[model samples]
Target: MVNTRDLRVIAVLISLLFTAFFVLIILFRGEIDTAATATVESYGLVAIFLGVFLLELLPQYISPHLLVINAIFLGFHIVPIILVSILGHIFASLLGFHLGKVYGFRLVEKLYSDKTVSKISSGMDRYGRWIVLLSAFLPFPYIPVIFGSLDLTWKNFWIFGIIPRAISFALLGFGLSFLTF
Candidate 1:
């Protein structure tokens, strides 16, 4: 008999598994041009949106950088790409926030040692919104989870988190666009 807690965990795990399967398909199928760009172009913004969404939701599995580069490679105009990517990231962060709200510190504990999670939690408490803002540029994959775990207000999270992340992805996308190869 699965209790509610067990059911919730099962749901999260199943979602993760599906995300993993999609990541594997993206990783192993072929070259970026053949597999990734083709898929992005074929599906247009929806594909890009979903790819970036998973990139945030399962940061350990997908490379956010690679997703942006692939989108650029497919000749997605910079503004739309940035907008779609930011929306996806914000949506994923909101999901993580709710998950954190429901499961609390256990989510962080599962990903990191108790000591590490405590330290991070402490830093978040002390630093608050600044930490959330800086995380966008710092490659701190677990920032959303941390913020969610702390039950940071939605207003603060959206304002602090989304802008910096959008700027970061824009810089990255435009920078990558300049490379000859």
Candidate 2:
């Protein structure tokens, strides 16, 4: 069985790994965006699906919204972009939720600063399911792990989290179209 020391070690390692990822993202934002845009242009919706899936499944890489926006600027229809993104995001969120259920928040807690954790936990405690909705609608990370770790019901997660996420994407697609390229 893993002892407290072992768990702490694992948490530290995870923290380091995520920190490295965040640093890379900051350092290579332009290159990553160009490469991501090239991939979507080359592969089309398939690239968007995979990119969104992987980004959502893992933490601290990149936001899938960027990919969707890239697709928009690339002249792909908003409908397909929203549809593909929602599908990819929902699947990833479900898997992340299950991962939370299996693993709990101990390891995940290491991923964020203490203040961020407090915000997430407090928002969850005070607002309950609405936290999921807000997270979905806003630019907040769709961290199903936190929701699942907090023992949110699947129905609530779907209704408050998944659905609103889809709606937000739809809104983004439509709303962004109004802006000049």
Candidate 3:
């Protein structure tokens, strides 16, 4: 087994590869086919990779549309979406955790504003894990902004984030499955 840092590197590299592939397709989309789409689905870590890699650029949040993109557009099986969403949530949470850790609460506070960070901190202190679950279901940009504020361990974050994310994607699967062949 490798270290966590190495694993993060690998995940990031794999994600970049997928992103490069997507860029290529979009650049010349007339040639794309279901096989290309299927290949992306097979990556299994695309969503997590994308979220972790783009965490800063993407406003550091989770959303329902993200799940739908993972479930329907990414072309993965229902199970994969659930699994990836959990892992993605973990990866995303970890990204935010380290940001908080590296930057420290004060620096992070400066990034937002004293009052806003205080409000978010207060919310996390008050709401705790249920807010994480709500963020998973509500489809707003809560994970990075809120869960990141809590600064919990990756283990706890995954437990709270994954269960609800998987449930949401599973529901998406059951709902979408009905409309397909």
Of the two candidates 1 and 2, the one with more favorable lDDT, higher being better, is 2
Candidate 3 Cα errors over 4 Å, as ranges: 1-48, 51-58, 61-67, 70-76, 110-119, 144-159
Error of 3 at 75 (Å): 4.8
List TM-scores for all candidates, in order.
0.67, 0.72, 0.53
- Give the Cα lDDT of each candidate: 0.69, 0.75, 0.55
Q: 1-181 in candidate 2: lDDT tens per residue?
A: 2354665676578657756755665566667667766665568888778878887776533467777766675567788888999899889999988887778778567554455557778899999889889888776767887778888999999999988888887888888887624
In candidate 3, clashing pairs total 1
TM-score: model 3 vs. ground truth = 0.53
Better of 2 and 3 by TM-score: 2
lDDT of 1 by residue, 99-157 (tens): 87788877766754555466667778799777778777885544577677787887888
Clashing pairs counted in every model: 0, 0, 1
Root-mean-square deviation of Cα positions for candidate 1 versus the true structure, in angstroms: 6.6
**Residue pairs in collision within model 2:** none
Highest-scoring model, lDDT: 2
